[model samples]
Target: MKVIAYGASTSSTSINKALATYAANLIPGADVTVLDINDYPVPMFSEDKEKEIGQAEAAKAFLDAIATADALVISFAEHNGHYPAAYKNLFDWSTRIDQKVFKDIPAVYLATSPGPGGAQSVLAAAKGSAPFFGGNVKATVSVASFYDNFDLEKGQPTNSAVADEIKAAVAKLNA
Candidate 1:
């Protein structure tokens, strides 16, 4: 499978990115592309901006990247329990190019936080909205208290139960 993965954040050291990469690699023999939102920066979306600048190549490229994917691994980073501006801006512009932004791609939706809720609000939002934008969300995973649950050295969850949960989801994604 050709998989496109990304953390919906602009941070260079995004924990969601780390989690996304790890999960993407779990798919057996899949070729994965981990895209950085920083690379696809677009000016904040506004009707005025759209009228002035027209569609950007960056937004089209972002849409094309996922359009060609056999599957997707997306991890949303919660900013005030919502999508960060950068990703949301890209979404807005890209949707103008193609209403089905995800191109009907099957996906494993994930979220994480240093706190106990694990960014669940954002994950829930993505799960609910993804389908409207052509995302076939297959499963969801959330890592709560990320620092305590994930082991960077091992590149997996520290808790066996969490690990098993993630593994099962990854397996389903691969299936």
Candidate 2:
């Protein structure tokens, strides 16, 4: 199986990125490719920008990546209760090219934050929008108060309950 995973954030040391990597590692015997949203930077989406720049290579590349995935692992990093700028901008660019950006692939969506909300608002937003983008959001994992729950040395959640929840959610995609 081909698992394409990415943290929907651009920060160099993003906790969302760390979560995505850890989740991908749990999918037994699969080829995994982790993507950085920053790699697909396109100008802010706009009719004017579209007319000026024409077709965007980054946008097409993003779509092509999703098209090749047997399953997807995306962990959202919330910024002000929404997707970070890099991810949102890439998403906007891809949607202009094709509204069904995920091309009907099954997906595991996750979110994490230093606070108790666990980036739940963003996860809810992603769940709400996934169908429109052709993403089969099979399962979701949310880790709240990340600093307290996650261990940087172990590269996973320190709390067993939180860790188990993530494992269970990842299992749903494998199915």
Candidate 3:
């Protein structure tokens, strides 16, 4: 299966990116493509911008990535308990290209934070909104205190429970 993974943040050191990449790697026989939202940066989505520039090449690339994926793994970084601006911009542009941005693909939605909440609010919002965009949410994970639960030096999950949960989620998608 082909899996597309991304973090909904532009931060260079995004914990969400780390978590998403780890989760994607867990899927057996899965060919994963990990995307950095920063690379697909487009002018903030405004009706005016759309009218003047039409679809940005970056947005087209993002949509193309989603279109080729069999499954998706997204780890959202919440900004004030909501979607980050970078991610929201990408979502807006992608939807303009394809109303159903997710294209009915199975997905594993995830979130992570240095604090205790672990981006649960954004994760919840994604779970609720995904189906409307043609996504099938197979599993979700919220990793709290990401620095404590993950080993940055090793680039792996240090929390066994969280690792098991991620493995189970991957299995569900693979099934």
Candidate 4:
């Protein structure tokens, strides 16, 4: 499968990005493309900006990237219990290009944080609203206390149960 995966943040060293990349690699024999939202930067979306820039090339590029995916794995980064500003901005622009941003692609949504809450608030929001944007959400995983559960050197979850959960979630795309 051709999997398009990304963390929903622009941070240079995003834990969510690392998590997303790790999870995407778990799908056996899958070709994974890990994207950085920074590569598709766009001005913050607004009616006025839309009028000024009609259709953003970056937004179109973002959608085009999704079009190439057989499956998607997105790890959301929560900032103050919500989507990160940079991701939300690019997503808003992409929506303008097509409200169905995911184009019905089967997806696994994940979230991670250093704290115990696991960024579940944003994960819930993403899961709750995915269908509205045509995301075929197959599973969702939230990794809590990221530093404790994840092994940076190994680039995978140190907690065996969490690793299993993520593996199970990604496996659904093939199903």
Against the hidden reference, what TM-scores do the models get? 0.96, 0.97, 0.97, 0.99
lDDT of 3 by residue, 63-145 (tens): 88888999999999999999998889889998888878888888999999999998999999999988778878999999999
lDDT of 4 at 163: 97
lDDT of 4 by residue, 11-64 (tens): 999999999999999999899999999999898899999999899999899999
Tens-place lDDT digits, model 2, residues 1-175: 8999999988998899899989888899889999988888898888899999986889999999888899899999999999998789889889989999988888899999999999999999999999998889989988999999998778888899988988898888867
Model 1 lDDT tens row, 90-164: 989999889899887889999998899999999999999887899888889999999899987777778988888
- Give me the candidate number with maximum TM-score: 4
Task: In candidate 2, list every pair of residues with a backbone clash.
Answer: none
Best candidate, lDDT-wise? 4
- The segments of candidate 1 whose C-alpha lies over 4 angstroms from its true place after superposition are none
Q: What is the C-alpha RMSD of each candidate to the true structure, in Å?
A: 1.1, 0.9, 0.9, 0.6
Off by over 4 Å in 4: none
Note the clash tally of each candidate. Answer: 0, 0, 0, 0
For model 3, the superposed segments whose C-alpha errors exceed 4 Å read none
Cα deviation in Å at residue 49, candidate 1?
Answer: 0.7
Ranking by lDDT: 4, 3, 2, 1
Residue 27: error of model 1 in Å? 0.5
Q: Candidate 2 local accuracy as lDDT?
A: 0.90
